[model samples]
Each structure stands twice: as C-alpha cells, then as structure tokens.
Target chain A: MSVELIILIVVITALIFDFTNGFHDAANAMATCVATGAFKPKMAVLLAAIMNLIGAFLSTNVAKTISGGIVDDQLITPQTVFAALVGAILWNLLTWLFGLPSSSSHAIFGALIGAVLVQAGLIGIHFSTVASKILLPALVAPVVAGVASYLGTKIAYKGKHNLPKESKKRYRNAQRVSSLLVALSHGTSDGQKTMGIITLVLVAGTLQLGGDQMPWWGQAPGTGPHWWVILSAGIAIALGTYSGGWRIMRTMGKGMAEIEPPQGFAAETAGMSCILASSHLGFGLSTTHIVSGAIMGTGLARTPEEVRWNTAKRMLIAWGLTLPAAALVGGLAAWVAHFGSWGFLVVLAVLVIGSVTIKIVSSKNHVSHENVNDSHEVTVLAKAAISSVTETIPNPLAPALPEEIADHPLAASPLRLTGLKPRPKPKVPKKKKTPPKSKKKKQRKAAQQKAAVAKAQEHEAAREKAAKAKAAKEKAAATRAAKAAKAKEVNDA
Target chain B: MPSLIYAIDWMALLLVAAVSIAATVIIAALMSVSNYFFHPPKGEEKASQPRRILGFIFLGLMACVVAFGLYLMIPYFH
Candidate 1:
C-alpha cells in the first residue's frame, strides 16, 4: 500500500480505538449515578455523552505526548501504530465482553510498547517510564481516591441513621451534578488521545513523503491536533459513550457496591476531584482506577460486607492483566504485519473475527438498559418468585427446579398454586415418534402424576368427613337447647 | 525503587490527594448541611423562612463549587 493509504488506515484505526475507549470508560462517570437511580440508564449515558463531547472541546494539552512517553517517539511508525491499535481495540472488546472495567489508556500504552519491542527491540521501549507512570499511578490512584470517598461517605451519613425523603432528593441532585462533572473530565482527558495518535501518523507520513517543511495545519505540535482532528475525535468518543457499555455499567454500578444516593454523591465527587486535580498537576492518573477505588471506598464506609470483595478481586485481576494481555496481542499483530500489506490484512482479519465472536458471545446473556439494574446473579425478585413457586407448586413440571427449593403446601392444589395448565391424563401413547430417554422420562412423570392424584383424593375425602361431623354436632346442640326450654315452660304451668 | 520514587513528582501526588479530599469533604458537608436545614427531625415544626433560606444558601454554595469544577476542567480558562 502507498504511504498515504497506510497513514489513512492508521488514522481510521486510531479513531476506532478511540470509540472503544469511549464505551469502555463510560461506566467510570455514570455507574454510581445509574446505580443510585439518580439517572435512568439511557438518560445517564446520553448525558455522559454530551458532557464528554463538551469536555473534549475544552482542552488539548494532553494530546502532545501520544504514548504518554511510554515508547520512543523516534521509532514509532504508522504500521506499528496500526498494530498497536488493533491490540488495544481487541483487548477492550475482550474486557467489555466479560464486563470488566479495564483501563483503555493502559491498553494503548501496552500495545505501543509491544509493537515497538517487536519493531526495534528493547531500545524502542522505556522501562522506567512504564514503571513510574503507569504502574505507580495504577497502584496509588485508587487508594487515594478510595480514602477520599470513604471520608466523604462518612460525612454524608453522619448524625443520621435514615435520611429523610427531602434529604435523599437533595443528595440525588448533588450526585447528578458530580456524575456530570466526571463525564466532562473523562471527555477532556480521553478525547484528546485519539487526536494525538492521528496527528502523529500525519506528521510521520508527511516526513516520509520527503516534505522539507511542516504542513500548515501541523506546523506547531504544541498547538495540538488540527481542528478537524479534534472535531472527529470528539464526535467518535461521544458516539461511543452514547452506545452504552451496559455490561460493564452493571458490573461497576451494582456488582461492586449497593450505592445509595448519598454514597453515589460521595464516590462520584471523590473520583471527579481526584481526576481533575491529578490531570492539572501534570501526572494523569487512570480515571477508571480512581473511580473504581472511590466506589470501593464508599462501599467500605457503609460497611465492610457491603463491598463485594469477590467482584473487586475479579476487577483487580482484569486491571492487572490489561497491560500484559494487550501487549501480547500487539506483539503478535506486529510480528504478523511486519511481512507487509498482505500480513497487515491478515492481522486485520483476525481482529475483526475476534471482535465479532466476542460480540456474539456477549449477546447470549444480554444486559441492556431495560435489565441493566438486574444483578448478574439471580435477583431478589427472581429469588422471591422461585420461593413462592417452589413452596406452593413443587411439581416436576415447574421448569428446571434447583435442588435448594424444597416443597411447601398450604391447603391448595399445585394446579391453583402454579397457574400451570393442567395436563390431560397420559393416555397410553400409540405409535408416537418419541426419543427413548424422553419416553422413559414421560413414563416416570405419569407415575408421579398418578400418585399426586391419589393424594389429592385422600385429602378431599378427609375434608368431607370433617365437614359432616361438624354439621351433626351442631344439630344435636340445637335440639338439646329446645328441649330444655320446653321442660322449663311445663314446670311453670 | 528509589529511582521510581525519584521519578515521581511527590508534590503533585500530595496536591492531588489534598485537593480531592478537601473538595469531597467540603462538597459532601455542604450538601448534608443543606439537607439538614430543609429536613429537620420528624417532630420539629416546619422550618422557618430564614432557615429554609439558609438551606438554599448552602445549595447555592454547592452550585458555586460545581461551577469552579467546570472552570477547572476547561483549559481555555486555565
């Protein structure tokens, strides 16, 4: 492929990566708000999208260092960037499929390192930058944000066991405001990364074409990405945000903590503050890590048990794996794509196939705006339904009963209890096309049905007998009272 | 380990922690105080006009804080 064509492909790939980044991190800003019912799932994502778009337009400072100083700028090639994006995009899809909130930025850094390692060996990588920037911040950001959230939550619940209705509404309003800020901050920080990548590719392509001077648009690197670059990146991220990663939202919002309005307000404010402050201080922290930490802190503030440690552990594992996993993928893609245009095409094919497979697999147990609030595990309502159904109608036909649900009865027939249509008595089937296992199961079911019928008849007989005896005793009492009255009247005469 | 520590800007980390904590605590406290004024104990009579106004004042302060946050996010102002 021509240099311009390759550059164009890389630009498109970077935009695709930016889109994935948008959806993957949407949970960070809006999860708590959605969990607390401050915003409906659809409305929450929509508001977050708008805020991210606005936030993207608000700043360009972060776009200067494309890899955040992780890889050697001198060695980065358009082809390597393409491989890196493929790795990042695939990793993001993989994490999103499992509903884990992994860091999209770290994925990019890892991919860049991996691709560069293959392209130029160890010399192209900066080990110290990785250690100091990505690793340290990943470890520290969460803890700091968590502590702030904990203290804020404590203050929120101070001097009150149960907040009044009016107070909850007030907290809800505050939570909404905090959540919007988080979204805006997310947009500002993440929206520019794509712009930087695009700009980097453009500059590299122009130089490779033997241009002695910089393009009019790219004359000053510090001036940031071209106006169109910013616009396109902003739109791409916003659209991705609007798409809504309901799976990850469910995991973060409900899986981690049972967030109330007060806790939501606290966690969001804590996260937003940390993000804004850290970014301003020139050492950008992972927004995902900070928000996740804040959420856990709020959970702890309520009670230790309120925080789902198992879910937290799972998330921690995902965060730890994000870098290495993306790096591995990036390395493999780079190795394959190093062969030339055909090799790049092959890598692209694999990425597409992998993404489609993940998307298909995720659809099996769908989580959408309608069911986003439902916990991954069987929800309380579903559990209640199971109990009521099992208690009154513990028949074999009640679809696939678990072993834990035991039979219960309250003077009611299973038919009335379950509201299931009564099956016709199994007439001995003649010449039916039946599988052998199903036929045997059917025979067993028939036997059980006969026994249940017999039990019902016995119960009916006993009830009738008791009712007759009660009628006879009442008759005898009335006759005795009448005779006593007659005897008293005769004695008076 | 020492080099990693040296590489990190400790002042920035400290600033982040302090700013985040201070902002969180202040915002949460303001919201709580406003809620308290608007909704006192169950047995108490309805809050007087001045108390309600005080509650609004707290909420207004919260709005101001939010505005400051907006300003911080926008690099144009910075």
Candidate 2:
C-alpha cells in the first residue's frame, strides 16, 4: 500500500491505543472514589472522562518527549509505529482481561523500543534518554508517591482522631476533589503519549516525502504535537474513560487495598501531585504505578494486614513482565509488518480476530457498572469452562424429567442433551371483561375532573400574581410619600 | 558500584524524588490540617474563629499550589 494509506492506518491504530490507555488507567483516577462510594461508578467515570479531556489540552511536553526522545525518528517509519501500537493495545487488552493494572505507558515504550530494534537495530534506540527520562522516573515516582501517601495517611488518621464522624464526611468530599485532580493529571501525562506517537508519524511521513529539508507544514522539526493531534488524542481518551474499565477498577479500588475515605483522599492527592510534577518535567511517568503504589502505601499505613500481599505481588509481577512481554510482541509484529502490503493485511486480520475473541471471552463473565464493587474474582477462561460443564450436567438421582423437557424434540435425540431443553413459556393470566357503558362514563368523569383541576390551578396562579402586583404598588406609593415628606422637611430647615 | 551509579542521572532522579515526595506530603498535610481545624469532634461547637481562619488559610494555600501546578502543565506556560 501507499505510504499515505499506511500513515492513515497508523494514526487510527494510535488512537485505538489511546482509547485503551484511557479506559485501562481510568481506575487510577476513579478507583478510590468508587471504592469509598464517594461517587457511583458511572458518575466517577464521567467525571474522570471530562477531566481527562481538559487535561489533554494542558500540556504537550510529555508528547514532545515521547515523539522525539525515546526512538530515533529518522530511522523508523509509520509502519514501525503501527506495529508498536499493536503490541501496546494487545498488552493493554490482555492486562485488562486479567484485571491487572499494568502501565500502558511502559507497554507503549517497550513496543516502540522493540519495533525500533527490529527496524533500525540498536542505534535507533536511545539508551541514555530511555534510562533517564522513562526508566528512572518510573522507578522513583511511584516510591515517592507511596511514601508520601503512607505518611499522609498517618497524618490524616491523626486528624481523624479529633473528629471521627465529621472527618469521614470531609475526607469523602476531599477524596472527590483529589480524584478529579488525578484524572486531570492523568490526561496531561498519559493522553499525550498517543499525541506524541501521532506527531512522530506525521514527522516521519513528512521527512520521508521531502528528503533532508523540513516540510513547510511540519515547521520546527520537533517543537510539540499539532493542535489536531492533541484534540483527537483528547477525544479518544475521553470516550474510553466514559466506557469505564470496571474490571481493573475493581482490582485497584478494592483488590490490592481495602481503602477508607481518608486513605482514598491521601492516595489520590499523592498520585495527582506526582503525575502533575512528572508531566511538567516532561517525564512520561506511569499514572498506574504512582496510583497503585499510593493505594498500597495507604493500605500499609491503615493496617498492614488489610493489604493483600498476594494480589500486590501478582500486580508487581505484571509490572515487571510488561516491558519484555510487550517488547516480544512488538518485535514479532515489526518483523511480520516488514513484508510490505500483504503482511500489513495479515496483521490487521489477526488484530481483528484476536480482539473479537478476547471480547467474546470477556463477555462470559462481564464486569460492568452495576456489579463493579462486588469484590469477586473475575471469571477466567478455565473457570468459565468448568461452570459451563457443571451447568450441563443433570443430577442423576432426580425423580423425573419436567413435562416440557420430556416433550421436546431434542430430548428424544440420541445425544441426550440435558441442558438443551426448550424453555417453557409462561401462561398469560385471563383478563376480566368490563361493561362498555360504565367504562365510557368513568373516562368522561376523569377528563372532566382533570379539566377542573387545571382551571383551579390557573385561578390560584392569577390570584397570587395579582397579590404580588398590589404589594409592589403599595410599597412604591409609600416610598414616594416618604421621599416627598423628607424633601419638604429639608426645605423648611 | 560507581560505574553503575554513573550510568544513571543521579541529579535528575533526586530532583524527581524530592519534588514528588515534597508535593505529595504537602498536599496530604494540608488535607490533614483542614480536617483537624474545619471538622471538629462531635458534640463540640463548630470550629472556633481562630481555627476556622487557620483552616481557610491552609485550604487557600492548597488551592493555590494545585492551580499553579496545573498552570505549569499547559503547553503555553512551558
């Protein structure tokens, strides 16, 4: 396919990845609010969505960092970026399916690194920039947020001792505000990653078309993402946030830690502060890591026992594996996509099929707004399979078959499908007949009564209006008389 | 150990940690202080004049800090 067509496909893929990032990390902004019941799941998601969109307009520093910092733009093509996005999106979907709060930022970084490695070899990847800008910040930002949250939680509790009931109410209100900040900060940081990717694509496309000289539309090689890029990224994330990632929200809000109102406030505040600072510094820090660490820190401060160590460990494992796992997928995708148009077609087909399959599997035990806080383990493929099997089996000791099942055609088949019995329809209750003349009389009476009530209401409104007008006129006359008397007294004096 | 340490940008890392930690702690402290002063214990009279004044001061400071941070996030500001 043509480079323009390929660029279009890459941009669309980048937006898809942005959408996944929004929904996946939504829990970072909203989990505590949902957990503390400060806001309903739907309301929390909506608030985060709005804040994220606003946040996207706040800064392009992080986007500039991603577009021009991590990988050498000169070496990689739009196709390479497309392959990286595929890796990141698939990783995000996989992590979401398992309800693990892995970093979408890391996934994107890893995918880009891997794809670039495959395309232009080791020199195309910038080790120093990656180490300083991405890796170091990822490691330290979370720790700082965690410690701050832990101490913050302790301080919050100390304050709570003075005002138990009132503090709880205050904390809940404060938590809502803090979560909003976190959502906005998330928009500033995470939303820009997609903007950066899209900008890089445009930059790379323009560079390819015009040899060494910079194109007119491109302007200053790497100042920041364009306005349209930022807008699209913002909208994609907002739409994703509105969708609500209940599965991961459940994991973060309740699974890793049993959060209270005060802890939620502290955690969200710390996460928001860290994210804002990092974004301003142009560090593409993971909002997931910062929020997760804060949640764990709060859990430890409140009651170490309350923190689910196993769940925490599992999440840590996911975090550790995210880079390499996404890298592997990205590398493989890059290799496949290197084979021209036919390869792109094959990869697209696989992506569609894979996404549909994951969707189907997720639907078997869906987590949605209604039951997000039920605190049950998500239905895994194995568990779903077992449940399906159990549902099919009939108790052998049962007295007799139901009449409906016995009479069904499939029941007589050699397969003896126990669970395939046709459902029996409910019998409608017979209606009692009424005399037509009485019904007509009642209807007319009801209409006449309605008209009388309307007329009475209008009469009452007119009377009230007249009373208000009379009071106004009386007050105006009294004021006028008082003013004349005052003027006459002044003249006499 | 020195070589490994040299490989990383210690100054940048320290700055990130210090700023993040300080910001987080300050915000949390502000929240704690607000809770203590604004929401007094049950059966007690609402916050006294002095305490209420202090509480408002803390809240105003916190709001300013957050607003500044957000202001810095805008592309134009950078």
Candidate 3:
C-alpha cells in the first residue's frame, strides 16, 4: 500500500515535469517566429500548442527508456523516482525564473542519477552512458546546428541589398512552417519523456511487489506507455505550451540576438532539421541548446556584434549547472524520503514551498507577452530602477507629464519622461523685468511677440493709408467750393 | 576511455550532423534561388515567364522536402 502511494506520487510528479517541459521548451520553436513578427505572441504559442498535441500522439518509442539505462531501475523504488522529479521540477522553475533555456531532459537525467546515488550508491549508475549520451550530444549537437544555421543564414541573405517586400513576406511564411516543425519535434521528443517515466514507475511498482503476476496498468519493461498515459501527457503538455513561457521567450528571441525574418526562417529551418535528424538517429539532443546555437549562429552570420555574449555565457553556465544542481537537489530529496513516510511528506512540503516562492519572486518581475519583444536587459534594468525610484522618491512632478509616459515601464526618471520643468528664475532688478520663463516658454513667447509685432505694423500701415485718402478728399472738396465761389462772383459782375 | 568510446555511436552522430547541415543548406539555397527569380531586386527587369515558372518549381521542391521531414516524424511511416 505504501509502495502504491509512492507510485501515485511519482506519476503525478512526472506529469508536472512534463508540463514544465512543455513551457520551458515552448521558446525553442516559437521565439524566432514571434521575434520576426511572423506570428503574434498569443497566436504563435497557440499554434505551437496545437502542433505539440498532434506530435505527442505520433509515437511512443522514446517512452521505452528512462535515462537510456543510466539508473538501474531495479535497485531504486518509486520514491527515488519521485525525488528525482521533484529535483527536476524545481530546477526547471529556477531556470525559468532566470529566463534561461536549459534542457528538461538533462534535468531529469541528472536528478535520476542523484536519486540513484542515494538509493543504491555509485554502482547503480552507468557513467559511460552519462558521458556519451548526455555530455557528448550536449556538446556536439549545438555545434552542428550552429554551423548549419550559419550557412543557412548566409544563403538566405545572398544578393541581399534591398530584399523585396514580397521575398521578405515569403520568408516570414517559410519561418512559420519551419517553426511548426520545431514545435512538433519538441512535442515528439519531450512529451514522451514523462510518459516514459510514468510507465517506468508503474512497471517498477508492479514487478517489485507482484513479481510474475502482471497488473492491468503495468506492462513489461520494453512495452509502450498506456493509452491513458498518452492522452494525459499530451493534454498536460499542450496546456503548458499554451501557458506561454514569456520570460524564456524574451531571452531567446530578443536577449541573445535580434532576429530578422529571413534569419529567423533560416534558424528555425536549420534547428528543426538538426533536431529531426538527431532524433531519427536515436540521439537525445536538447531542442533548447540546438535552437539557441542556431539563433546565435544566424546572428553571427549577419552581424556578430549584435549577439549578446554575456547572456550566452550566462545560459552556458546555467546549462553546465543544470545536471549537477538537479542532482544535488534530487539527492537531498531522496535522503529526506529515505527516513520514512514522514520524510516523503517533508519532501513534498519542500517542493510546494520552493515552487510557491519562485512563483512569487517571478511575479514581482513580471514579463508578459506585451513587453516580451522589448530589449530584455535594458527593459528589466529600467523597470527595476523605476520601481525602486517610485518606492523611494515620490515624484512631485509626475502629474506634470502625460499619464501614459509617467506610468511607462521605461520611464525611470520623471525629468527624462517629460523633458519639461519650470526653469529657475534669473535674478534681475525687481522693477526692470517680469519673471523669466523656461527656455521653451520663452521661445513660445518670442514667437507670439513676433506675430503680435507683425500685426501691429500691418495695423499702422492700414491707418496711414486711410488718413492720407481722407486728407486728399477734404482738399478736393475745398478746391471745389472755392471754384464755385469764384464762378458766382464772375457771373454777378 | 575505451568504454566511453564504445558507449557512443560516432558514425550515427556524424551522419545526423551531415544530413541536417545538408538539408538546411539545400533548403536555404533553394529558397534564395526562388526569391531571386520570383521577386527580383527593384530597378531591374522583371523575371521572364519561364524563369518565374522555374522559381515555382524550386519552391515546390522545398515544400516537398519539408513534407518529407514531417513524414519522417510520423512513427507509422517508419
């Protein structure tokens, strides 16, 4: 009964891990497409979700192995698997909080290795598989994809000056297609991992207790995941993809490199092809690593300076730490669960508490689809500065600026936002002059005065013309009167 | 060292790399050629009818390759 309870926990945790896997890798497919404006942010995620749903039902071959036989499943119980999942989920959330695209597959593998170490000691792990399968592919796959994308981007830009609007539009359309393939490839690879884990847990539980008696839910070690498992895993992952990992999307799309439509098309094509080929060859390469490398390669092909090496370095560090960090946490979880059922409850408590804390911290620095396309580091820093400023210094002049500008994320300084402030009055003899205005106001006043002066001059000119005409008319009338008087006197004589 | 070497299938890895790079390069080249003829640079004569048809043919080929990639993903196809 205790073992069954553990198995239930393991299955639930596996599904949760699958959910994280979906969102964590959502950027791998849609980031380039969204960055290039081929699809709107919400629309891109929706398309990726639909493709992921279709791809999950495509195959169950990858579900056959958990860690490719790295951890000896017979030695470890479902409790160990539960601990491993806890570690992987925490790591996934941690990396997501930092907006780093690390591998969910590697995280699980690392956690399994850690849990195995705690349960069955060093003898339970296959070190060679770890090196060749995990480490080797991690190193090599990215390089291959990078080189391919570099070449592809070059080909895309050939005869490039003033690329026609029609051609650019076509490239965006091509980017959408290639991005869909990537999303499908991600679904086929990642969605199957949780199914694999859940199946392993069921098999391990049934075989350990029942021995030769085959249970309804449990199949042989080499058998496919059950239909219910497939449906649940597919739905969980599709829902997660629809949730849209905006933080990681922003990091991949705008942080590492700025992607143009043609470059995005090339990167998605190259990355998708690499992932498909590797998966076909039974190599478990990370979609995140391959796509990130392809984007960097494409950026370098066009303008090397645009690639943010700092962010890339940070991502590389996170990738390096993913396995070991997950291992540490998983090992700790296994250690706690080894104490008893109480320890298991304690582990569950830690997982929930840790997840909640990370969520709270992430909410404090929220990155939604609206601000996802903004330059990441600058926007984050600016937002941080503004929030701090707003807390510390109450901007007395905030009302003076436009309401929208004052409340903008990038508007850190009120002075900078409005660029208008009352100028300090210059000291002049009190009787000599009125108060000095701001430079802008002075310029406006000068313009107004110039218009007034021009109006006054026109008025004076019109008055002089009227007065001259009146004087000329009066002289004519007098002359007529004198002429009449002279004529009358001549007539009387 | 020997164990590590045995654990990896180097030939398969190299094959995957080669195939992916080749496919990407070919697709990119085909798309470029299609664009070059279909939507030529401004201040130049429009591509002739035969050239436009040739561009369409290249585009059709690219579409076929993408479809082939999709076909590879389907497990039943294997």
lDDT of 1 by residue, A1-493 (tens): 7887788788888888988999999999999888889999999999999999998888876555578678888888888899999999999998898888999999988888899999899998878789878998899889999999999999999945456677788889889989999999889888988888888788777777766666554334445577888898999999999989888898889888787899899999999889888887876789999999999999899866877898889889988998899999999999999999999889889988998898887776667787787664322212222222323444555454454543323223356345655444357858877679989999999999999999999999999999999989989888999998999999998
The C-alpha stretches of model 2 lying farther than 4 A from their native spots are: A61-68, A159-163, A210-226, A281-284, A382-493, B1-4, B41-45
Q: Sort all candidates by DockQ, best to worst.
A: 3, 1, 2
| A205-266: candidate 2 lDDT, tens digit per residue | 78667767665445345667778888999999999998998889989998887888989988
lDDT of candidates 1 onward, in order: 0.84, 0.80, 0.85
Using all chains and alpha carbons, the TM-scores for the candidates as numbered come to 0.79, 0.76, 0.83
Task: Name model 1 segments beyond 4 Å from true.
Answer: A159-161, A211-223, A376-493
Assess candidate 1 and give its lDDT: 0.84
Model 1 clashing residue pairs (backbone) = none
| Candidate 1 docking band | medium
In terms of TM-score, which candidate is strongest?
A: 3
TM-score of 3: 0.83
Tens digits of lDDT, candidate 3, A292-402: 999999988888887899999999999999999999999999999898989999999999999999888887777777767855552332344232233344466555657
